[model samples]
Target: FADLKRDRHDDETINTVFRSVHSIKGGAGAFGHERLQHFSHHYETLLDLIRNGTLPLSEPLIDLIVAAFDTLADHVI
Candidate 1:
C-alpha cells in the first residue's frame, strides 16, 4: 500500500515491512548467513529510501521490491 492502493494509514504497512526486513537482516547476520544478510541489507535499504521519500514509489519499483523479497524468501527457506 505504498502507491496505487495507498491510503492515509498505508504508511503503517510500509513501516511494518521495513521493520520486518530489518529484523531478518539482523538475525541473518547473527547466524552467519551472509547471503541472507547481504540481500536483506540491500532490500532494507531500498525500503528505507522509499519510506523516507528518497525514492519515489511507483509500480515498477514495487515490482522490483516484490521480486527482491521473493529472493529473500528463497534465502530463508
Candidate 2:
C-alpha cells in the first residue's frame, strides 16, 4: 500500500501484493479462516484485474484499493 500509494502504477508492488494475497487466501482456506479467505479472494481478484489490464488504474480505483488495504489489515490481524 505504501509503495503503490507513492506510485499507483508500481507494477512491482502490485505483483508483490497479488502474490502475498494469493498466499494468504490459500493459507486462510487451508486453516479455516473463511472470512479472510473470502475477502482475500475478492481482493486478489481485483488485483489480478488491475495487473492484467482488465481494470484501469484510475485515481478513484487507487483510492478504493487503499481503502481495501486498510480493511485487509483488520482481517489479517
Candidate 3:
C-alpha cells in the first residue's frame, strides 16, 4: 500500500501487488475460503490489467484498489 501510495504506476510495485494477491487467492482456495478466493480472483484480474498496460493507474482506481485490500485484510482476520 505504501508503494502504491507513493507511485501507483510503478511496474515493480504493481507486479508485487499482483503476485501477493495471487498468492492470497491460492491460499484461500486451499483453505476452502470460496468467497475470498472469488474476491481475490477478481482483484487479481484488475491488477493484471494494470500490470499489462490495459488499465491506466487512475487515482480513483487506486482508491478502489486500496479499499479492496482493506476488504481482503478484513476477511483474513
On residues 1-77, what C-alpha lDDT tens digit does candidate 2 reach at each position?
66565673578778988898899899999999999999999999999999998997877878888788788877787
TM-score of each: 0.83, 0.86, 0.90
User: Candidate 2, clashing residue pairs?
Assistant: none
Q: Judge candidate 2 against the unseen true structure and give its global Cα lDDT, from 0 to 1.
A: 0.85
Higher-scoring candidate on lDDT, 1 or 2? 2
Model 2 weakest 10-residue run by lDDT:
1-10
Ranking by lDDT: 3, 2, 1
What tens digits encode model 1's per-residue C-alpha lDDT throughout 1-77? 44434433466667887998999999999999998899899999999998998998777877787687778778777
Poorest 10 consecutive residues of model 3 by lDDT?
Answer: 1-10
User: What residue pairs clash in candidate 3, if any at all?
Assistant: none
Every candidate's lDDT:
0.81, 0.85, 0.89
Highest lDDT against the true fold, candidate? 3
Candidate 1: residue pairs that collide = none
Q: Which one wins on TM-score? A: 3
Residue 76 in candidate 3, Cα distance off native in Å:
1.1
